[model samples]
Target: MTTERQFQHDSQGPLRRIVSSVFSIFETRLELIGIELSEEKERLIGVLFLGLAAMMLTMMALITLTVLIAIAFWGTYRWQSLAAITAVYVLVAIVCALRARAGLSNAPNVFESTLAEFKKDRDTFN
Candidate 1:
């Protein structure tokens, strides 16, 4: 009975080793994939920051130019000049709206693509 038990234990040794090896391979692969995902997320955040900075700079420049123009034109015309100034402001607003729409349209659709890729990876692993 002791000899039979020894045979049974010996038979399980290789099976256990194989299972452990398979698990180790899977774990290593998961680690590598996690590293890749983290790098990608960092890159995306950098891009978002750059876009935000550019937008802020553009708005600041626009504001500065508008103020300079208003100051330069102040008191240069009749009382009806206020109406003209109001019209100019309206036009600027419309132009700004169009530019905002264009910028939004051009923005990268990275979120959807990233989500889809992650879902695909998740399904593959599952």
Candidate 2:
């Protein structure tokens, strides 16, 4: 009876350790995700504010320049100048769209670290 009890206790010890280790791993991964989320949020807000400011300044400058160009041409070449400006704007828009698409494609996946940690755990178990 004593030998059976000792064997049971020994089995329980490893089981307890396994459970504890699993919980510890989960807690650590959760903490890392929380930290990454906070950082991403802050970065997004900062980028939004900066983008707004840049857009406002660019619009103001474009308007001012357009008016200046129109006044400079007055009667002659006025239509041509406006057409050229429109063409340039269209080209710039296309380039910006393509670049934005490329940037999105190249961006790293979110939760990459978590996935890596899980992979490590799987490998260890295997």
Pairs that collide, model 1 = none
TM-score for all models, in order of appearance = 0.50, 0.90
RMSD of each: 6.1, 1.5
RMSD of 1: 6.1
Per-residue accuracy of model 2 over 1-126 as CA lDDT, tens digit each = 999999999999999999999999989989989988888889889999998999899989998998999899878999999999889889988998999899989988788988898899889989
Number of the top lDDT candidate:
2
Taken over the whole model, the C-alpha lDDT of each candidate is 0.75, 0.91
TM-score, cand. 1 vs. native: 0.50
- How would you encode candidate 1's per-residue C-alpha lDDT over 1-126 as one tens digit per residue? 999999999999998997897687667666667776787799979989997998899779867866666677677754455566568778987998999799879986544544565576568668
